[model samples]
Target: MAQNLVLIAGATGQIGASVARHVMDRSGWDLVGLSRRVQQHVPCPMLAVDLLDAEDCRRKLGGMQGVTHVVYAARYDHAGGELESVDINLQMLSNLLTAVKDRPDLRHIHVVHGTKYYGHNAGPGPVPYRENAPRSPRPVFYYAQQDFLIQQQGGQAWDWSISRPHTFCDLVLDEPRSITLLVAIYASMLKELGLPLRFPGTQLAFKSRTQFTWLPMLARSIEWMITDRTCANQAFNVVNGDAERWSALWPAIADYFDMACGDPEPERLARFPESHSDIWCDMVSLHGLRPSELSTVAQWAYGDYVFSPEWDVVSSMDKAREHGLTESIDTRQMWRDSFDFYRSHKIIP
Candidate 1:
């Protein structure tokens, strides 16, 4: 009896999961989640899908009757610092669109993109990256995917919008790519070794201004853009309204762990888990913490990439504000709250 039936692709990822909850809460829409793995904890019916397999996409999404909107938050797996396959990523989106675009009630499709679109990973682009900035000289799947969406929507009744968010933070404890969980687990390991908390990146990185998109606010913004008619056929940058340098926050983080703040020591955070596996095990047993392998708790390669950005990574929020999605969160307070959640949930000792 619901007016809308929304299909959330990549539903098990942090963005997809959080957005699913927010869409359900705000609009009372019927929901379905599409991902390779089925999560028992997700809020809606989950379709185990293989977006890479065109036949699988057809079998699963081809007949999703009454599906009114698609929130494509899915990404093809790729290692950090590696070139993502443009063909593979584009095919995934193309498969999803082919399967569902003909649905009579389909009104909108929303794509979740990231700051990598601005070339933050390759080095840095212009500061406060505006939505209208030219495509990065480097090859990225984002360019291919966005272009495909625009091409496919040429004469279709449905409309599309894309959101470009930077590193997004949520308090979810078990997420492997979480920046907050990476920091929590790293600090716990270092504390167990009786070492001071060190800023584990270059001096330039420590002092660089960066921004984060609070996950909940991003979910709300996605919901706003999809339902609001004015946001159609456009792309907008979604981020915390403010930015900060790690140098300004390192002291507070050190204080939170009750440890001294040491000088910046550039480290390959990807090496931490294997190097300190024994320490992690000891901490888990000593604190009676949940049993989980340290490697499974956080992917430090993601940490390495996040902590190694030596240039300022600011994205402008003016476009989203002008488009009428004005929600914002304090980045520093967002971090503190995330750490507090991990502690309350006993995800860290």
Candidate 2:
């Protein structure tokens, strides 16, 4: 119905690449993907440009020049080794916004943010965060990118929206991209060794009440925001709409992997209560290389988070529903899809 030209930054990232692919599927929309390198297997039109450079990014991001919309997924992905990731994100954000300033055809902007903006870095509060909640005072540098958007949109000249999705998992290809999926893979390894598939060693804060969002759903939602004016100037929470206990979710995962969860005796568990480890401890144990081979049964257990006894806050998308967004993905189905995808790609070794 409409001619659209779209630009996406961070096109090679786990989320960004998926978003790019989805947008490319649009009939009347032209998608330009910006990345540092032209990786093999990319289907969309890509421009090799450094987003950190304001001038180059402006020249390269075609959508800014009478182009339809811009989606900023760019971030420092050096495995979190760059301690100044927040600062880097904020600067790139400021540059990108300035580069596209005052473009006539720019209709909307959709930025992907996680629940980390809800002060997950601080701690979960009972606030049940709404889209309009006050920016966190202890804002991480990443939040600044969002604040910049709010400031730009406050002028009311362009269509703008933000999506705060919760606990999304990807193809389990890396450490930082999909942490929950990383945990799932670890749990799979545990089941291989006849270990308990349930939360081991510690009780988590959220007690494993978590929801997952699928890749296709997240990507398409961004596309929806771009084409629909009704989505303007609002914030939305993306949830998988399914919640499950941390303990019970393990069996579902076991079924997906076709692996058996070893039954731990209740009395024996009571005696060796310290057998399972928190997320961090389990990682250190596994990577510590205590055993040369996988011959010994590693008594340690792996779970959702390194820190336990904290509440895993559930995000609600009720407000988004009020604004004409009704679609969502199922958690269990989404996780199984990701598992199958990773196995198919041989991504998890």
Candidate topping lDDT: 1
Evaluate residue 152 in candidate 2 and report its C-alpha lDDT on the 0 to 100 scale. 80
The TM-score leader among the candidates is 1
Residue-wise C-alpha lDDT for candidate 2, range 1-349, written one tens digit per residue: 4488777877877677888778777788888787878665566788887767888867765344556788877776553212337777887877777777567777887778876676754666654557666666664664677668888876656777777776666553432446444545456556545666544424553254555667678887777777778888766777666656655676677777666653422222222224443433444365452221221122112122332325555677778778777887767777777767755644332
**What's model 1's lDDT at 338?**
87
On residues 1-349, what C-alpha lDDT tens digit does candidate 1 reach at each position? 8888889999998999999888778655889999998989887789899998999989888887899999999988887778889899899999999999988889999999988888988886788899889888888898998899899999899999999998888877568888878888887777778898888899999999888898999998988899999999999999988888889888888888888888899888888877787888888889988888887788888888888889999999888888787688987788889888988888888
Question: Model 1: how far is 200 from its true place, Å?
Answer: 0.9
How many clashes does each candidate structure show, in the order listed?
A: 0, 5
Candidate 2: residue 195 Cα off by (Å)? 2.7
lDDT of each: 0.87, 0.63
Cα TM-score of candidate 1: 0.96
